[model samples]
Target chain A: MIARLLKKNHSTEYEELLEQIAQGQPLPTDELEDETRPMAQAANWLAQRRAALDPRPGYVRASRQRLVARLQARGGKRPWLHRHWGDIAWWQHPLAHLALVMLLVASAFLSASRLAVASRAWLPGDLLYPLKPMAEQAALLASLTKEGDAQLHIEFAHRRLIEAQSLVFENRYEQLPAAVADFDRHVSQAVILVNQMAGDQQDEARSLATELQQALSGQMGMLMLLTNLTPDASQAEFQRLLMISEDGVSDLRNVLTPDGGDAQHQGWKVTPRVSMHWLGEG
Target chain B: MPDRQHADETRLVQQAQKGDVEAFGQLYEFYAPLVFRFLFSHLDDRLDAEDLTEDVFMRVWEALPGFRARGVPFGGYLFRVARNALYDHYRRNRRRSSDAELNLEWEDNFHPDPAESVPMNIEHGELRASLAKLREDYRTVLTLRFLVGLSTEEIAVAMRRSAGAVRVLQHRALLSLRQELERQESEENDRQTFKEEPLNGV
Candidate 1:
């Protein structure tokens, strides 16, 4: 019965006692029942013992100095190349120079490939996310044809659009603008690349433009769905991006049909040339 | 004063997050002793405590960039790190410890504050000794409560328990400690009596 009473009153009375001790308050008159005195006394003794625990000043001072020195040392690091550079004499030996060049190239290739693979899944706001775009740019430069470059740009735009949708879904609104901006840039670049082809690659260029129109059409539907889901503060930006996507899709449809009219106006749905997969679908 | 100190710490944490090593060093200065005392009370070894204190700060420095002060204070985060470091130390050194080491001299080596140079009484000494004999959770609750001066909520965050559970555990721990102190006191009395009775017989 006493234990039950203590448990019932613990939130108020005993808690007040604990709060008072925690605040270093002087104890009040002896109103605590007999069952509580021993615990209160134990608490008092524990508090007193707590006062006795003082870390040696010498240790504290010495450790602080050592830690500051270590922090400074860590902050003052120089580039490894600066430390390893020697006179040009080492470069005079062609074999040594060739081997060093090969080693540098091999290490760079391995590290870049590993970083690209590691950063593949990283989104905006991640430390490795910048590497993802750098890798995509490197891939764009490696493509041998304008059509190939346009396809790569479309692929990158698709990834960024998915990332933007994910940012909205995850409620990371701060990074949403960055992801949307990236998607806009990629889509714009893909359209420009498709428009640049005029001479012998015209047929393929028109086909790529048609594909771009289809993708943008599908993305327009996704963006409209997301606009309703986006928070009020970000709705304006989402609408602006949606308008840009609409304009791009209209411009591509005019270029594809050669009559400056949309596929819907021409009385036929634009069939997707590729796999026709949209974001968030299986 | 506490408000000003908290503001200063918040500013320092922000600067540290931005790669200011000096700001982090200042944080180390503020929290190192508390971390050391907590570690020492748990491990009962001065060297291990100091080493783990340094390790804990190093980790805090590395993890400062990701630390957001969303509801959880930096001190609570730091104590959590210290607890993890203590557990890691135990796992690594489990085979090296034996029961004999628990009785190592604590008061003899305790560096009392120069301003408060009052000598410890017998009860304080006995209490400190008996504290080492309690179970891990009891000792930890008491140490974080009294030595570290954490509130029940902070202790709950550190121990990953609810505030009510912490309160109940603390009450049980204090009762257990009182029992331990009584047991030690009786042992000391019986030993003294045994010594004096021989002289009385003589």
Candidate 2:
């Protein structure tokens, strides 16, 4: 009975055993029942515990080595790097010069990418890239650059600005999640203006245009990052998740509020996560 | 790859740095699964994971010969590559309209039993396939909690966040895992996963 009790329903016993395991106490063999030994899953449990206890590295490379070996075997015939740079060997080769160039190129690319990832990092210098016009679009939207073709210019600039914003977000490229919070605010403000304009608030459009102008005001230290054509990517990315969070909330809200009734978002409340739609359960 | 495997990796890395596509491909085959595992952890969709895995390998191929192999382990370098790729994927995909985000509620057919053909498990050959069906934070936390076994502090280190954040992540991870585990119970074909105490010298 004791063996049966210990073996069959061993969770409590397992707990005690785990404690013993932690203390480095040896579990008694004869005193324990068969079930006390992991029945079918003893292997996986130990593996999980071992993994938890001491994390191993290199399974990552294990996956790569098989293919890498195949790739290398193919390279034995004609080693490109050896062929090209073989004459210059390590000491004579421009490895230093090349590494320097590579580093500079990588650095510039990554920096530009970081900026391109978010509008917040935009600088006077970056404006020289396709991004300058994005800032200028905000001005154009406000008709700040009512160049001979006003409506056409706003439409063109706004479209381009939206495209730039889309490109940044499209990449989901994250450098520092917080860096883009300002950009998110800017994006949201632009969205709100667009929404209002859609609702025919021409007067309110100017306010949005002005908000965008102020948003792009100071370079905010982007000067240094903007000089590079490319840069080494950082470990993490910047994102303006709040805009998405709010967007999620708005999405649920719209679903809750029946369209064509009260146009105001006040008709129904919505949470950031769950969607409480008026539609019946399927 | 094992800790002992770097000598081989070093050979490949040296060749790859020279823009040997074949050498880089070798590196890809070895690291691809780990990259896929982490990618699956970060992103739910398998196709997306596969795509990102390809991207990470391509980036490695592009950047290898110039890559500095010292100071950082090859795994670290691969991880850096995968992380950059994932960030790019997130920027491209997650920012889309909310409609793009599939609902998280359970489907009647996604039963753990293979016979029932769970939509989530359509992909095969990976233990983590179903886990990848989970939400982003939940999937990551579970991967770290179970697969990586980083203590809360360690997890915080991995995520570059505070321990409190890791704790929060753990809580959420457990909740999501519990739900999925229970959902597995709904399947007729659900069989208990295996385990054994393979203690050293035992």
Q: What's the lDDT for all of these models? A: 0.67, 0.42
lDDT of 1 by residue, B10-109 (tens): 8898887776877877788778877886886666455677888999987777666667676667777788778878866764665443223654454344
Record all residue pairs in model 1 with backbone atoms less than 3 Å apart, i.e. clashing. none
Scanning candidate 1 chain A in windows of ten residues, the lowest lDDT window is: A82-91
What is the DockQ of the complex in model 1?
0.14
How well docked is model 2, in DockQ terms?
A: 0.10
Model 2 error, position A213 (Å): 28
Q: By TM-score, how accurate is candidate 1?
A: 0.52
**Across residues B35-142, which tens digit of lDDT does each residue of candidate 2 receive?**
676765454455566667766775665455545654445665566556557767765665431224543442332233556345323332123434555555555544
In terms of lDDT, which candidate is strongest? 1
C-alpha lDDT (0 to 100) for residue A126 of candidate 2? 43
Model 1 clash tally?
0
Q: Given candidate 2, what's the lDDT at residue B43?
A: 49
State interface RMSD in Å for all models. 16.1, 13.3
TM-scores, one per candidate: 0.52, 0.36
Residue by residue across A144-191, what tens digits does model 2's lDDT show? 422212333323333332333333444433423433433443343443
Q: Second chain only: TM-score per model? A: 0.83, 0.55
TM-score (chain A only) for the predictions, listed in order: 0.54, 0.22
User: Model 2, stretches more than 4 Å misplaced?
Assistant: A1-240, A243-282, B1-15, B18-23, B40-48, B65-71, B90-100, B103-135, B144-176, B179-202
